[model samples]
Target: MMSTATAIQERSLLGLKHLSREDILAILDRASYWEQQSEKLVPILNKKFAVNMFFENSTRTRFSFEMAQKRLGVQVMNFTAAASSVEKGESIYDTVRTLESMGVDAGVVRLKPSGVLQELAQRVRIPLINAGDGNNEHPTQALLDLYTMRKVFGELQGLTVSIIGDIKHSRVARSNLWALQKLGAKVQFCAPSVMSAPELAEHAPYVSMEEALKADVVMMLRVQLERHSGGLFQSSEEYREQYGLTEERAASLLGHTIIMHPAPVNRNVEIDDAVVECDRSYIFRQMAHGVPVRMAVMERAMRD
Candidate 1:
């Protein structure tokens, strides 16, 4: 009979919504162990090959997954839409099937369309990890973000987390809402009227920027200028004054309150440069935690 962990290995991690609270905790506990030994490479994934198939461009997520794979002794195959046969109009199913034929044991995929990863998972035999799928979810990122919060507060129950900005187009926000709420954290969404989604408001109530900044964790999201059509906000300066985490706003938060952002920040647009480096900011630490959390996920997906 297969153990629970072994059963997890056979399943595709398309979203956090599919995981139980115990499963989420198990991943976090495993991540904590990896965090303690992050500087040392492990052979947990020795002799395995994992392919990275990213249809959308990314910096932090792509590199962190590659680092996690290498640190665990897995051979990395990097694939980009521009360089791959995807340019020749090949389907995602064909691309993944080709990689599988080459003995790729697992894959981390990021696509611009929602639910495509889940569709691909049905056709693929190996475990599929969703890096980010459109405006749907980024499950691993939510895991890392949860890990960061747990590291700081030592618990997630009853804690308040306010996710600010670009909620309509943010996969991070979608993932975090589900994961955080499942772990007993109260989540609130704060965004420009145009950027707020009614669907998310059903999970987390929409709060004003002032109310959101007062939470225990203030997570500012990128404005996602590329994803938006036209005129979401009236002006950059107006948005900053109303919603951005400026130096003054960050300073006003109690010392116990922490500021966070999923990066490639717009500098002064969503968050001020000074606020990102402020004493209460955990923005960079969040990035540091990404490797170990992802390492935990990879280990779980490939465990025998």
Candidate 2:
């Protein structure tokens, strides 16, 4: 017997910021179940239609959600802003309303403007999953990240995760911060002063790059140079030298420490090429785990 509040909450994943510890764990547990399945396709969601509306460009998140939907046998409609009426100045809300009118069961969305997803969720009739909403949050990414950590450590309790690089512009950092702390994991940030989020200083301490490497998980975010105004650093090489996970820095990490990055990696910018595929790096594993985690999320969104 699910309460009305619980039913609504489970139907849409706007972000992990509001999810309780039990809610987070339940998603992880379900993801583990999906990963264990030997069947290539479950088809439990056959005939259910989902729309992926990407107002912004994406590689991993877009494809991952599509794969997750397909695995469950949900019919998928992918909408790219560049190819749609959005280019002719249609409001995001109008575009969504048009799709909802077409009888979509769910919408997985990514957009450049912050706080708009909340408005959409309020207005839309169908369930909506936040693929990303500006720099506010990327709920599914954080969920997958948590799943990856849980797989390695067996639990989230007592784990220390340091998220390094571009904190001020990272939705991933914010999502991870809220969700990890709720699950009893320690969350820390390591970023240059210019890239640090002053709003979050009260929540997690910003550590130096050297100190950040000691955590159970060292998650490196993309440098996001396109978002910067002027020169944050003189060059990518300099950013690498200062904040990037160089081979030397990677060597100093604890034996139990694991490296991570939510990629579109910068090659040698935020992390060295040598360390990208190193035994301790979980970047690829993170991408691999995104499938099942999202499958769990899609199932939850459409589940009765």
lDDT scores of the candidates, listed in order = 0.88, 0.92
C-alpha TM-scores of all predictions: 0.95, 0.97
- Residue 15 error, candidate 1, Å: 0.8
Per-residue lDDT tens digits for candidate 1, residues 72-139, read 99989899999988999999899999998889888999999998888788777789999999999999
- Candidate 1 contains a number of clashing pairs equal to 0
Task: Itemize residue pairs with steric clashes in candidate 1.
Answer: none
Highest TM-score: which candidate?
2
RMSD of each: 2.0, 1.6
| Cα lDDT for residue 301, candidate 2 | 92
Candidate 2 per-residue lDDT over residues 1-304, each given as its tens digit: 9865556556999998888888899999999999999997999999799999999999789999999999999999999999999899999999999999999989999999999998888877788999999899999999999999999999889999999999999999999999999989999999988899999999999998888989999999999676675857878888999999999999999999999888878999999999999999999999999999999999999976
The worst-scoring run of ten residues by lDDT in candidate 1 lies at: 3-12
